[model samples]
Target: MNEGDDDISVDKNEDSAVLASPEVLETSFFINKPSKKKLKKGVFNRTWLNWVEYKSFLKEYNHDSSQAACIVCNQQFSVYYCSKAEIDNHIKTKKHQHHMKSYDVNQQLIT
Candidate 1:
């Protein structure tokens, strides 16, 4: 067996992702081609609304979008990449608590 053969021991197949050589892999001169760049699309899931902690004020701002709205604070939050972390952080903020108290007071006055 040739010593160079060990470099490409992978089984050859039509659908194999292993490139034949480094030159073949570097055929494209462009550093960042649109086809190479991945676009991450986020979607606001309805199931997040069912969480006991978030159900009270968390809601979907748009159908199948990457955004959630806080009912108590009257604010919209992006849930891209990290969905629950963004939502839970917003709920834990002092501003949200203040808004919650104000909303409750306003509701009490109405009742």
Candidate 2:
């Protein structure tokens, strides 16, 4: 009928077409699968750290014995009783170093 009425109908048709498209429907079923990463065993595997060593640097995280949180930086880490490499790597991070420095300063002030 009117030019404006025609444009309105065309827009509605396009919107409906997009909503009913098979591709749009199929997209709802699409899911991204996560890839599983294989962890390489470190050389220190099978050697567990004693409580003194563990407590010196890490604290129990989330009440999970298998996970540890750094005492200085509060960074969470997996406890591989078999390996010390992971713990060593975390301790060597710049963030850990910075936090450790701050912790030492605080301790000095407290004393």
Candidate 3:
């Protein structure tokens, strides 16, 4: 075989040896353009002032450091991490009956 013919064959093989399929090559699977809705307008959001009407407790305790304190039991806590509902769980505990009695006595004096 002639050396020139071998070179031509090697060039043909190189052209045919595309590692990626046409689907992979034609479209970029990397960059994602932002949608018109997301880019065009600011999202409607409740400000802190607006939120205060509902999450008043969050404002009272300064948001991040806030703990939900049980009004009856005086237990200050991060409510999300707490295993059980405060008032319900407290009612099941032995001390709850004593607290109820004390609370009744206090209410009587106020009346």
Q: Cα RMSD (Å) between model 1 and the true structure?
A: 12.0
Clashes of 3: 0
TM-score of model number 2: 0.47
Highest lDDT scorer? 1
Residue-pair clashes per candidate: 0, 2, 0
Better of 1 and 2 by TM-score: 1
lDDT of 3 by residue, 1-111 (tens): 766564544564467665888777656553454445533222212342255322322122234333444344554544344323432454566665676578668878999
lDDT of 1 by residue, 31-60 (tens): 455556675755677887787878878889
**lDDT tens readout by residue for model 2, 1-111:** 766564544554355554556876676556554557888643332234355545545655665556667878867777554346678778788998888788878988999
What TM-score goes with each of the models? 0.55, 0.47, 0.34
Q: Lowest-lDDT window of 10 residues in candidate 1?
A: 28-37
- Tell me the lDDT of candidate 1: 0.80
Which residues of candidate 2, in runs, are more than 4 Å off?
A: 1-56
Whole-model lDDT, model 3: 0.45
> What residue pairs clash in candidate 1, if any at all?
none
